[model samples]
Target chain A: MIEPGSFRDPTSRVFYDAGRVFRGLSHEAAEVDAEVRSSGLMNDLVSRGLFVDNWIVNDVTPPSGVSSVSVIESERVPLVTYPAEWPFSILKDAALATLDANLISLERGFILKDASAFNAVLRGVTPVIIDVTSIERFGERGIWTAYGQFCDHFLAPLMLEAYAGIPIHRTLRSRTDGFPIGDLGRLLRGRSGFRKGVLSHVRIRNFFENRAAGMETSERRDVGKATLARPAIVASIQKMRGLVGSLESCAPSTWADYESALPYEESSIDEKDRFVSEAAVKAGAKGLAVDVGANVGRFTGILAEHFDLVVGMDNDPGAADGLYDTVRRSDFTNVTPLVVDMTNPTEAFGWRGKERAALSDRLHPDFATWLAVVHHLCLGIGIPLDEVVEQIFDFCGESVVEFVAADDPMAQRISATRSTDLAPYGVEEFEEYVARRGVVLNKKPVSDTRTLYHLKGR
Target chain B: MTDPLFAYIDPGAGATLAQLALAGTAGLAAIGKLRMNKIKNRLTGKVSVDSESEPDVPSDESAATE
Candidate 1:
């Protein structure tokens, strides 16, 4: 019996048991896989180690196409990640790898049928292309079926990071399927924007996209090349790579707010870091977490030890930039940073339909750190304490959070510009709020105005 | 006799944890539980607990209190 799964790629179905894996395909899909294999694309990818464990020959004849297609039994990989979880550098690397894969696919007589970032998943620092089904033979009139997808998945996000000084963090968490066209288009179409390729690649698609909004339900599909001339596809892919780089090199971070604001004073920062490290170890959390107002990831960096993983999430590019820069400079295996607007967090969404992984879903029962974060969400962002508790309890098992006073200078700065709809942040109120939701550990005073509360879900 | 293991791979960060101890005599069943629950949750998006963070007793502190 086969337990079929994986919804992103409609054509291929993944199955596994006893350390073995199988891929079920309809007759046509198997034929396509065979074509990809016989055409030598599979061998090329295997040779380059671009793929994870590979297809093992099998005899489960599928029921589509000209003839029955047999299942391609394969080895099961240990992990499957979506783009939303990746830090900026990892996403960039995935895009570069995808471009490289496209180039390689052309060399091996195939084209990446879908250059969507979802085709890749990270295993540590290495970015491996996971979706074998997203390939087809190269042809002269090859349409970038994944073109619109790539724009949403890779190009748009990259450009946002490059030009607008927004880290692609929101794109990752909010758009696991791919960044929504409307949002990316809005970002790219900002006032005085649409410079060069942005107009061509993004605006053009946005036009067709708005046009295609609801005219047709969908259309019948096929397995073969949309077009099969090698030269044209290769040229287009090359142009795409150039465009991607320009998107990457658009502009670096230039936010004065980041320059002016201090995430943490030197002494407070170090002590906070040490405190987090000790807590994460004590909690036996497989991972440590920092809410994005994470500033520079100092707490996450310090807690990176002892815990198997550390996640630094912050909404600001200037802040995420610092986090990403640290991850890039170090060999810290466990640390990751994401862009999160905590006031409106990214919700869980699926690959195909609603029956897949959401942004917050995870296999690990976790331990987390929400340091220096609640105040920004509370005083600055206007999220309620109860909702904050709910978000944490949903994602983590045990968590530690900092309750910064409304009068704190840092709190004042974060809220000075924004409308603080919520009442002023208070330690007593926060303690009571936490207690109602779960068992609140004793408070550890990080400062007169800033204190950390350890928590366990009741 | 056979053994199994528990692996939690966070999709966003790609930070995964594998508990080798979960494969031993003490953990063999725990491994089975992990695998079982993982499959259930993977195919079906079920957050193990809802109202998980809801306070045991209602709190006066809220958005108004911040």
Candidate 2:
């Protein structure tokens, strides 16, 4: 089937046949593809792991009615995630990778025509550009056409996080096209609007944009006549690199220190680990495993040892960023960290909501660890226990769920803020709901107030 | 045939102008250097390399208009 998200680029379309990913290029795009390949740039980028690995499929037929003169097959990414599901570091790394690829392409007499963050996919910890068709022969126009997009998609969001201390994932969820500069200008109007990169890329650009909006068509066209040399263009991108590289998230993570502050004794913590490991063994050591509330990835690291690929997911941006740092520092090639709020998980977005698949639809894990997350989903978010059990089971074949009693210190702390009585948040009621939806294979108590159940959906 | 240099997203005219403006004095220096090279080449009866090699393609904004 034709990939719905691939429709924006008319010259090329992505389609999946059987299990492999393929791209059908139009006659013009095919010519450009041939040039890209012949120039040796494709091989160079692929070898560097900066671009997705793909090869020409000579004998294969293009999908029906999809215009193509040539077909190429690409290595499919294990899981596809959007910017809204990425932490600050992940987004920053993606932005750097995009710039690296663009700069390298420019050296080879080619350029990335667009700099959308969607073009870059996180392959484990590494960001690789998957949209090969975005690379095209550099025209005589020396100005980088993708500069505005780069700023809108990468710079603006990063600035918001770095300067305004705002988490951008939720904002990106709504503004799929990236934040508008006009709105960004007003949002960062005070001291932040005058910051180094923000001053030039945001404030000045906003001024020129507003001015251009008021100009006549002919006068607007005259603005395009102003050009820069290739060296000057390179300098501009290098400047962006310096600014983007220096940006760091200033927002504090709520759950970054959750594990440290846990009220559990050392023995209880060790017992919880032992239970999770035993559950992982029972689930079998293969395929994908997702740690639903993998804050700082303590259990995610253990799951990574058994499963071929482990996706560490957490709602807290700081915690997710910490998990990403762990993955990079330890060189865990099989672990992918994502910022996902289990309550309001990433939904099907883009055109008709079919362009990008929902997060749950994309992950089909063999096993899952829903530890320390149930209480938050239940008492914190007010999602019923039955609904929570069903939603957790929906993502994996089997899972180990930790039930934190309402009277537990953490649960009470969570419940203290709310006025509603959480009477049904007992171990007995949770087991009943779990048994209703699926079978409980084994049950182990970590402490007087917390218990772990190995469960499989019917 | 469709223009092969088509940009999927419209690179705003304001952005293009803004980039030039951001280039500031350095951009002016580069333009000046190119003009000087052309003048020097003419004085020495040498062919200008950039003039010969530059492709006759429309800028991104101009192409968007088309």
Candidate 3:
């Protein structure tokens, strides 16, 4: 049951068996464990919800070829999301959490050995460090070893998103290992390069890398031996925290105001929520939902109330960003909004293309709720109604979808330019298509032209 | 003596290059000084764990010795 991505650290490996996360530590890491236990830092952080708690499980024998001094187990995370799938605020929170961990480590005479963004996973809105083995005693703080990895994994991608207007997930998915400073510098040539933090962390670092490439091996080796004071390294960490902390998504707020812009009458909104909730109960949705195209997350919020976990995905970063802010401010721990264009879903990336699983693979939901996105997919994106139904079924076996008739004002507005030859488009056509492939649990008309249907895969 | 608690990470050439740019010549010189201290400690039979103390004098060493 060895987890595939847990091999990076030679000191420890994570295993999943019987629905539990077990960590096996090598003999070498025993002393580190002792030190960690003694420092009380781990306990303190865990108490604060910054890290997952692990308990020694002495009775369990580890797998072959592993000589573990200690075997500890924790509750397995149901969905492990990569940094690439996170929205702006989620990534920002993770970066701050990492820096906060480092600050706490500094006080305890230690630091994070690895600053990979993959080490942290969100528990609701809180970022928790899942890898306990990443902590190590800071001996000669002359060099912050994880600095490059941190900047590449967290800072660079963030700056690209905030300044260069590149989506964080897109940049991260392409460069799974980490964003290389050389390419980062090139992308950030003019206005972004002149920014304060960008100049040193990206541009200057690139300059040094280019300069080193020209020098002899001995010269480069000489440079490798260079060191900075411990205080300087700490200062650098502090400065970076400030830089990453200051970054805010400049994505337009047009979609943030989408809720007010909707033409749905108050009664129609109530009817939609009531129908979805009733369908959710009948579906026996114990806890997971994927709300596609969750503009301003109105339906997502309704879904969040019924489900333990709800991912509100929208193509507009502005809409997702607004939802994230709303979720953070409220007590809605189950809801998370991420920018995902349903047309081009996230694919499996990295080593062997298995490092980060595809978005579809990671999402195992009890139900999928497509409120108003079907019309957008069909009329807006020109995908056929049958194809849209197939995509919905592909997401989850049980679904509650709304059918916006071709004559609906919204649908008319969306396909105004296209031919009215929606030859195979109508409520009757949708019912016929689903009847051949699935069972229609219920169908209720919410408006003159809008109808909601609850369907289960055959 | 290598403390099992301490791990070695090859920070790679890119990181070293960044360190040089950030810290200049003074920083470069400190590396040699630190390396010389390592040699000096080896010759003098002194084990320096960190800037804070001698390796032989672990925080709980006196308790163990007694």
Candidate 4:
């Protein structure tokens, strides 16, 4: 299917046939295509791992059903993750990658016409530009065309996440285009108003936008030529590299201390890991495996060994960032870490709310493992067990999860201050929910109070 | 209502340039730092600072498997 998110770019459209991903260039993009091909810079960038590798499909005839002047097959990104879902460091890396691409493109007589965050995807931990068609011939436009987009898509969100402690991913759920500059200006403290980057990018931009809003189009046009010379634009790109490179570290969340606050004995943890690995191997999972509530990726590392891609998702931004660091350092090429809350996941947003797919729809895993988090979801958050199971089954073919007995220490502690309505919240009630939608393949009592079950959708 | 010659610079670009103009020497300092890094890399025969080995991104902390 031609992805809904791939429709905004008119120069090219991405399509998936069977299991492979391909891009079809419109006749209008023929010149850009030829320029990219003749230069061989795309291939060079691909070799250096800066650009996602794409090959011109010479042997095939545009896959017969597809129509275009030229067709190229791109290596399928294991998971199509968005910038909103990225950690501070990952977002910084993407910004650097964009500037790096611009610098390299300039060297090769081209420039990236689009700097949207959606154009880049994380393969493992490294950010690679996926949209090859965005590259265009560089000329004397005398302005950095993508400067504003770079700020909205990269700078604004990173600053908020870094300085204000607001999660960029959550903010992006409302508006995928970018965090509005005016909103950012207001959100940051008044003290930050004096900072140069903030002064120029946020405060001044808001000033101009507000002033422009009140002025007639003709009057606004009367403003002096803001076109930047080549050297100035080049300097701007270099300055952006420095700004992106120095983003402050994200503050730690409660889950950041999860490793030290872990309640389980080490032997019990090992047992749980063994149970999870054996269940995955028995189920023959190979597509995507997600560890929902994967605090710091303790179990995601095991899931990565079996699945083509493993997404470690958690609500805590700090935990997700920690997991990203862990996965990036390891030899595992199949794992990605993202900040996502299962209760309130990311929805489809962007142009007409279809430019970027919803988190549940886009990262639909073949199997999902929810470890030591069901109690927190049920007792701590008050979401019904049946609803949680149904939601989990809605996105995956099979699910492996654990249920904590209501009287367990962790469950009790979480629900301690709540009402005494604990009669209906038990392992039996949880199993009944699973049976309604799927078949239970195996169930193991991992501990005195915790039970693990592997189930397949009916 | 876009400028025909500078059609690429949208309102967002205007905002960015607004910020860059006000940033003053901060931008210049950044550019100078970049030039020094480039020269250092050139002298040491090191690959460009954009490589995966950049020290700006902290090294991965060991995963707690236990």
Q: Which candidate is the best by TM-score?
A: 2
**CAPRI verdict on model 2?**
incorrect
Better of 2 and 4 by DockQ: 2
Candidate number of the best lDDT: 2
Candidate 1 structure quality by residue, lDDT tens digits, A1-458 = 23322544445666554556666665556666787788777878766757655774655553332123456654444344556555556677778778777788777666675666766765534567877766665543433445555666887777776777665665566455566656766776556265656655566555534432221111001111113245544655577677776554333543314524665567776677666667777787464354445667666667666666555666555566567777768888666666555565555465344433544543343667777677766666687766776776766768777778887888887788876566635777776777777887656776677887778888
- By the DockQ metric, which is better: model 1 or model 4? 4
Better of 1 and 4 by lDDT: 4
Global Cα lDDT for candidate 3:
0.76
Clashing pairs in 3: none
Return the candidate ranking by TM-score, descending.
2, 3, 4, 1
Model 3 chain B weakest lDDT span, ten residues long: B51-60
Q: What is candidate 1's local distance difference test score?
A: 0.57
Q: lDDT (CA) for every model shown?
A: 0.57, 0.81, 0.76, 0.73
Q: Which runs of model 1 end up more than 4 angstroms from their true locations?
A: A1-10, A15-22, A31-50, A55-91, A125-127, A139-145, A160-228, A249-265, A285-292, A349-356, A362-365, A416-425, A437-443, B1-66
Task: Kindly indicate the candidate among 1 and 3 with the higher TM-score.
Answer: 3
Contacts from the true interface found in each model, as a fraction, amount to 0.00, 0.38, 0.22, 0.17
- Model 4 chain A: worst 10 consecutive residues (lDDT sum): A216-225
| Model 2 lDDT tens row, B3-61 | 33556667776687668767868555533443333333432445446443532334433
| Cα lDDT for residue A177, candidate 3 | 63
